[model samples]
Target chain A: MEIGAEAIVQNQTPKRAAVTTGADRPGRRPSSGRFRRLNVLVGVLSIPLFIILWELTSRSGIVNMVLFPPPTVVAAAVLEWMRSGQFFWDVAASLYRVTAGFLLGSALGVLLGILTGQFPVVSSLLSPLFQILRPIPPIAFVPIVILWFGLSEAGKLFLVVWGVFFTVWLSTHIGVQKVDRGLIRAALMLGTPRRQMLQEIILLGALPYIVVGLRTAVSISFYTLVAAELAGTFAGVVYRIEIAQQNLQTGQVMGGLAALGLISFIADRLFAALAERTVWWR
Target chain B: MSGYRSTTKLALASSQPSVKTVSEQPAIQVSNLSIVFDTNRGQMIAVDRVSFDVAAGEFVCIVGPSGCGKSTVLNTIAGLEVPFEGEILVEGSPVGHPRPDIGMVFQQPHLFPWKSVRRNIAHGPRMLGKSAKEAGAIADDLIAMIGLKRFADAYPNTLSGGMQQRVAIARALANEPRVLLMDEPFGALDAQTRAVMQDNLLELRDRIKATIVFVTHDIDEAIVLADRVLIMSAGPGRILREIAVNLPRPRSSAILIEPTYLALKRDCLEVIRAEGLRAFNQSDSS
Candidate 1:
């Protein structure tokens, strides 16, 4: 009976192999290639198609032109803003806030994260406090920040820093905790001193996680920037948008929003490129 | 296997004589070593009164079934295991913390992924306060010794399993430790690669004068590598017997076919089978 079963299996094996090989033959190749090409074509046309539809709707009286202006009108307003030279200053102001706040927040986050992750005593003291604060949205603190700083740059910086700090801290903490025990044992066996263990092994082990946290904080800095500007800023992209909104310059307001989105997108991409280099071995 | 036999023969032919010395104190002395872990089921004994002494420049293999606390014994000797009832003296000093004279290789390579092969090897020397130049020189020497000179700058992730294990061994030796502890270092490799690694290790062992204690479940590996093979039984690990392999030096996996080797292997199998049967009966009765 076993021999007969084996014979049946042997007979079916060639048929199964033939069917799979037939499916992989050259006759099926062009359809897959054509499908991939069609996907690329659709992807290339996606943004342009959306813009054209938006423009058509605005101009064809389907929407209020003043409120929902076309992309061309927004572009012209941006060009006008650039011609006046205020665009550069607005970008510089916003860039300065994001950069300063991100650096300060990331530094603090990493420091505290290493402290809490390494020592259980420190973790016991700080983790509970952090857990409480981490869930409260950074935007919610804007009103309180305004009351405290009264439109000062300190308040704006505080908002952005608060937004970035928790993300970086949590990831760094988890990363340090998740560092392989085998690696630690190996390092210990190699006579790695306690101080050097933290500096060399622990820090580098947690770096990949820290980079991930910092990347997340990049987008978060933009989110908090919105809150900070709305709270009250002298000059920033969001501030310009607010001013345009009040003056009823809908095109300028739309242009400001576009500029903000572009900056955030660029920041995310730049950090992603940097992150790849940061964890170079990956 | 046949391809590596020639290289093994060549390595043995060119290898220097063993530097085994009759020093006053043994390289490692473990007396009455016991470890207890507080698991969900009250307290469980991991190692029970395990005692052994490895002589200077001696190669010893501890062979046992999995969860036999053989690794725990190795770790305790390396000063990585704590809160255990034991007196482990390495070179006449009681083991408490990881010392510079001791080096260990784990089951996994555990090579710092961020570091290149050269840098990973240099890490031990650098931590010991050797200057970058000195550390680099040491790393380069070991890299050449391991025959991975071409891949000195390559990262661990890029290397094959056997190659990574070689680098790991080189890294452990970078400090020129007096005693080296290895816990199933080639257990993760395929059989073919494992044979090659064993041959490479035998060749490398000829040059380095460090006392080595290797742990494995493979009786064949233990016999091929060690001057003394310590057989251990699990369920609160304890040594069952110690068999001395009187095989000639500069040996490799090629000796598996030899009459004396087969006799020694039969002895080890009888001991292990008796232990396994006893444990099986005890568990069944329970």
Candidate 2:
């Protein structure tokens, strides 16, 4: 237990350089202490500072309060939307589309990526097609999607999935290809058979890249969700924003945007934490 | 089984009338092997008709200059590289792919980063269909032999370079390979650590029954560990000479300071210097 615990502690120190170095360095000075304190203070005050500037400008006869609503108006509008229970439905609808699309798209992307990456024949057949299709923006498909599926939920899912698939696919393909040949040779010398080679060596080797691709796809999923709901949706955060914008309810529009930003920010942070655990050896 | 094998051989000999080299039954054989590479400047010969044999349980070192294909020859024996011509036979079977009975340790430790020391060592046995408990038992034995008992559960990144290489050697031996191919396993270490590892390997070799074929450019390393040294020349690698080190068994790094050791080193250096001058003169004339 001592050895195991000691090893774990040693392994953790270098890994936590970002958090440890700021506190652990020996050359701490009084002026540097003040500078660090100032940095923390600024970080805490950042949102408030921006909100205060917006409020001052809106009320100081510099801008129309209705058109350029401040933080208080946006907060009040969000509260009202929550009270009406429409916020819950909007959030749920948007979340469902993003989650479902991400999972399906990520699954297909990983499958196809491994196929193309590991097998040259499959790569020769499909990579050129994926390359041609990848650059076309998902939003450009919105008009054609309406023609094909007529504002259905499937069309929305398609848009979100399309947004996510190519990124994960390409990253996975590259990751698989980039798996260290040294590791592969080492494994083969250990009597690993062909099929087991993929499972025991290739998958874990490429996982870091796949996790990175998935993280990028997280933001992409959100981007495409907005396009999907804006094209047409009965209830979604972006759909609510569209309706509020049409009615000149700039406060709700701003509130919806803020909510979207907050969600995306939390999601990114959560995935970053998960990514740390995924490639824990790093 | 021997009777049946001889009968089959007799039948095959009668049917084809093939030429068979009747010689000592060696553990590993590389006869007239050649490896060519397709370069930007057309085809280049990497190893040209190089041949050698290792008797059962013998430790052999192949020493040469950088780019002399010493590592290529070792890889061919490990079935990691295909010879352009000629064949490599290990344990009387034609070498084609990496077999469980063959183990290898590369210059870089190349430990699986995610695995603990024990798991890394256990991987060979586990891949060969040993149960988890059985593999663990085997790994623990090697861990003890390598003197890394305390760090059994340590990930590769936490260990020092020499420690990692010790683990690599242990991992390779978990399958009890008959022939172990080492390509500069200690080359990356500092002088002190390298000396320590060499001593450690000498001690470990006395206990294991594996035949070892080690490749190194270091002349002292070749003499200290190997029962026989195969000196190779560069630019289309060819065996220049063979020197058998008659040093007593159970030797240590301390033996490297002996007068006999110096004489052997001088002999090896003389051969290499002569080969170098020849290559240099050839290049100058060209």
Candidate 3:
């Protein structure tokens, strides 16, 4: 890639600003621009470096190619999976599970969180239940889920929902609790009608935290998906990985891991993009 | 300056003898008002026995120390807080709960983040059974009057603090309320912005010909904006003294530098100063 001189000049105004200020101004736009650029460069360079090291290790026989496989082999397997439509099916299945689970869990979480956060009586009543159950991991609930719903997609979905619920619920509850008292007072003094008070002041005040929780919930969905798949079904990418490990196809196992990582990254990026667009006011 | 000039023009035009006959009724009447809040320990008197009548089209400022319950008085009048004693009668009827006829502004702008400036301003009008067309017109007029026409569509976050408060003022006026209750509405702003907002408020008050009960801790602010300044004592907050600021109509920022303005400020300070000293002595002893 040829670097344009104007592009370099555009970038180097920071070089001018840096020499001018004795120390960089913190959190200011132009001052942070340099660090942002550096982070992007570091991120872009990481994959290539990993691939090069893998190829070098394969060629030098430092690691057996048959055991670990090179990046090219993994890429080829990914391409074959895509060609066979198995990759799309697996991705679609994972996406559906995450979407259904997160939406169901977060909807319930927000409603309960808002109710608890607003009224002290409600909070006290629910806090005990949350405290007791919150310590039990969603993975631990897999047995109960299976017992209740059978060892099927329903059980897997239940596990994922349970995993995401507490995360979103706690964040929203804390958010509503910590809403700026001044803002609430302002609304009340303005003679805001009672019914609209929660919707306008409380919920909107808690929105930024809810969004952060929603972002965190995506990670929880992936966590629960892999765990539930590993424990329950004889299908899903995790199941395929388990089967591959049993048959001693290490490359196929790594391939499954790569798919999981890709799905998580893409989903997170999409969610973050939505949040940035939606909650710019915060 | 343009703001006050327009207000003067409106006042002149609306000061017809027939107009006084048409709207001679008092906007708000607070008779024997007192507020006591029940905290965890016991009943705490926030506002002690107080009574005042705000005539239609008068600007009143209640000034005191930080904990003097100036805000409690405003909240009581607004019907947000129930007073332990006394009646706040608006237009000859007691205020039992919040009504659309009363508008309030607070220290924080409190503009809803989800709504644009225009939408926030239009909220009260729309809530009061006005059509979108009517609400939009009122919102537009208020926005223009507050000098925020250019920022009508902007979200609250995009605006400066002063601009956000301007939107808040516009929002309050949209209700076409008979009275405006403000509780340290400009106290949160920087000194420069606060000064500008004070000017804007006084100008708006003059133009609207609406009764305003403004609460603030700053004596200079009280003298600058008030037609009558009421000084309050702390702890079981009670009105200590009331002074009619007899400065000429359409006062400006330059009025603050006048000897009379300074004298009035000192008098108001003396009232709050005694309370301040007593508070400090109590704290020191404790």
- Highest-DockQ candidate: 1
Q: For residues A152-262, what per-residue lDDT tens digits would candidate 2 score against the true structure?
A: 999999999999999999999999999999999999999988799898889999999999999999999999999999899899999999999999999999999999999
List runs of model 2 lying over 4 Å from the truth. Answer: A1-28, B1-24
lDDT of each: 0.91, 0.90, 0.81
Tens digit of lDDT per residue, candidate 1, span A1-282? 223445878999999988997877858778999999999999999999999998999899989999999999989999999999999999999999999999999999999999999999999999999999999999999889988999999999999999999999999999999898888888888878887888888988888999999999999999999999998888999999999999999999999999999999999999999999999998
Q: Give the fraction of true interface contacts kept by model 1.
A: 0.75
| lDDT (C-alpha) at residue A134 in model 3 | 81
With candidate 1 superimposed using the best TM-score fit, by how many Å does residue A206's alpha carbon deviate from the native? 0.5
- DockQ, candidate 3, vs. native dimer: 0.26
Docking class of 3: acceptable
Candidate 2 positional error at B135, Å: 0.5
Full candidate order by DockQ, most accurate first = 1, 2, 3
**How close to the true structure is residue B65 of candidate 2, measured as C-alpha lDDT?**
97
- What tens digits encode model 3's per-residue C-alpha lDDT throughout B1-286? 2544366556774564311233556778877888888899999988888988777777889988888888888887887786469888987788867777788888788888878898888888776768889989989878878877778889999887788888988888888888888989888887777887887777676567567889998888889988789989888788889998988766766698999998888888887788789878998999
True contacts kept of each: 0.75, 0.71, 0.31
The DockQ of predicted model 2 stands at 0.36
Task: Give the Cα error of residue B228 in candidate 2, in Å.
Answer: 0.6
Each candidate: chain B TM-score: 0.94, 0.91, 0.91
